[model samples]
Target: MRPMNNAPLDTDRPNSLIIAPQWIGDAVMTEPLLRRLHARGERLTVGALPWVAPVYRAMPQVAEVIEFPFAHGGLQFRERRAIAKRVEGRFETAYVLPNSLKSALLPFLASIPRRVGYFGEARVGLLTHRLKNPKSKPPMVAFYSALSGESGFDADRPQLKFSDQDISAALARQGLPVSGYYVFAPGAEFGPAKRWPAKHFAELAASLDLPVLLLGSGKEAELCDEIVLLSNTANNAKCLSLAGKTSLTEALCLIAASRACISNDSGLMHVAAALGVRQVAIFGSSSPLHTPPLSDQASVLWLKNDASYQSPLDCAPCFERICPLGHTRCLNDISAQRVRDLL
Candidate 1:
């Protein structure tokens, strides 16, 4: 974890200001990176957004968490500048994770000695250790882990460590079956376009011989309820709707207990990858190549434009919410049968 010269990082002399990733999911994805940074020394602090503070509130890897009070993608030079002023004398190196040019300005303004990040918007001189974004990133876990200059990992391998007590606690909370149960995550926050058909989820539940737990945020509450209600079972007892129930950290514990996670390409899906839980990730209106799950057990199902849905729109890869065309062909055309086949 030595920065070139192997000198001790200085909080009193010069500390490291590490800019965190945006979104809980992205921040979760970068955990390995944080661990590597932590190994470097004990004086590293994270510069993160106010909303996403919960993601790393208790990470053993972070010494201090610096809150940046401003909307993501908004101009908060005042806020950023203020933070820069506060961290001015401490940071010797800054690791900027987000690709935004503005994300780099803080450490630069703080006048940190060395800045480390990908070479984006041509901030060559600003960052001292400009890592060339790898040509072939292994898996999600190892991808960011390279920042530590020691990426010994397997892309197909899932690798997050937790305590035995935590595992037992999570399973106990889940009410362990005589036999283990399957898990379903039926919603994607990026948009409804990423969601599978609700009735199809119910059908999937019915098809499974084991018990099920459905999980997601309150945003996916209706979708979860629909899945539970639509299941035409004797008691719908097989499916336990855990959606909107667990906190993100709690959900991580549960996903660790799951045998497999069937999900849309969403934060939970990324969580599956990080946890190295077996995953069946379905993709539509998006390219798997750009955002493929970085796990060997992580399988992806994406739609290629066929005659029925020719023309992958100019805005097709726009990654926008509420498709402008309103057709939702990307997801609508996807069938439950496809998901079943993967499962």
Candidate 2:
């Protein structure tokens, strides 16, 4: 974790603290709002979960980052009270990002003058200013920006700052070439339904005839290994499974250096988009309308399964982690040839 800035607050500047979202993609989407807040001359501090802290720390817009120590879905009321006490009377307002009642607890406990968030989880008294969530889900970027009273379907793409020196160092450390490589993100933290088939990815990598780097978290290392093996057999080209090998910052730099990136709808896709990497994002069991990559360089392909395989669910975007029907035709229907054509 980066050391917290303990500098005295500027009295002339209005201080604001944002309770950041936990998910990596949602955390990336929050950048536009942070940028706008900084532009308006609000000294910004982000309260982030431990895992997602790197996202805000990379942003120049953030003045400071406070690591929220509690585990996801774990209340830890005493811990919240301790945190509130530590940062008491520091900020004039707090922007609560998550809808959970637990998310609003710290700000309310600290007695921050203004608390703003959507009405959810019976948090009526916790928030001083309650915004109603839209009935229909909007793109996360627009939805988050709207919290600050900014109205738009579009916002500036999420940008992360990294030095070329850092990128070169990361590449050297991983024994990877500096350029002429394509990245494939085959892991989706959401569930298997959001992931493109491993066979399809292997086929695509084989046809590309370029160095392929597979990026993912430690959990996806096995999956990436399988793809690498299959790809090597198919094309006899170099395919390295770098899953779990690089840090988040290293992964960001690698994506920035790639010729192009092909990924399932996942956090790395958002990171690639943020870095202005040309990306082909595949979607299944989720709606692009809800959280599409906020980059003009991105091309999205959605494969919807209209026919029911076994379960009775008729909708294409079931939004469930695991497909209810058990058959993932939504992902299976997208051919390797189609994805290769995009590349």
Candidate 3:
């Protein structure tokens, strides 16, 4: 219950708002929507990540953040109900940004009178404002804007809002030398199709005269190691792998330190984009227009195919885990030389 400015709290209807975005990247991308809500006299309460609740909790714009115990698709019935009860009678309007069949259940059961979301996965009865998924919705920002009926969403890089305190705290924790270093996050949760070969990353790191900071989660430790060990760097100094070392908040601080970053289209890339770091974010499964990195300086490197190996596969950007075709030509075809040129 942070006291936002005293103003009328409704859209010619009623006020008090709570919104739950489907994922971390989407949550970051919806900063403009929160800003717009603030403009129209609405208090913001967000549902945050399952484990990394502290990151968004410290965010200035987020007055309240309740972390769901379940991961993205983990539907624990009792747990969801308890969370819903906690949220019940807390807000008059709840916005569900996810399009899944079950994304509406919690909000619906919570008894939030005005639930707003898109008409997807046959959840028509759940949403008060069932926005038609627009034909011209290229950027994901537009999708977030539609949540609160905000029109003409300017397609920019992802919109993430953080506080000076958050920035300060994050920076103080990571004491990395900032002299000419480029952060490289070459992992994607979208699975193997999105991952450019680890060896290629090593190749790219060798070419760079400056420091290359390798970043990812604990799950990506082995991959990061393979990249670091195999990479051929000139002098004695090696690429610093901070994959398992820092939390999400610490990573944010380190990402801000670098001159630029090269990442696969993943959460780290989204965060880098939000920080407005100069980025070269390569994309394969996810198209640039659909989910471009937030920074204007971010460039997406995609695979080009000729007669020999046409597209990643017939179902190239299928956006699935473990490529349907055994070989991941889309990412494999993108040579380290091509990435080197971008760097």
In terms of lDDT, the best-performing candidate is: 2
- Candidate 1: tens digits of C-alpha lDDT, residues 56-156: 65456666776677675676788778767766767668888876778888988889888877778867766777788777754555655666566564432
Q: What is the C-alpha lDDT of each candidate?
A: 0.70, 0.86, 0.71
Please tell me which model should have the higher lDDT, number 1 or number 2: 2
- In model 3, residue pairs whose N, Cα or C atoms come closer than 3 Å (at least 3 residues apart or on different chains), thus clashing, are 157-294, 158-294
Tell me how candidate 1 scores on lDDT: 0.70
lDDT of 1 at 325: 79
lDDT of 3 by residue, 190-265 (tens): 6877888888888888878787888888988888888888884442455878888877766776777778888888
How much is the lDDT of residue 83 in candidate 3? 71
Worst 10 residues of 2 by lDDT: 304-313
Q: Stretches of candidate 1 above 4 Å error?
A: 1-15, 35-44, 50-73, 76-88, 118-158, 170-179, 232-235, 305-330
* Model 2 regions lying over 4 Å from their true place: 1-3, 153-156, 305-315
Top TM-score model: 2
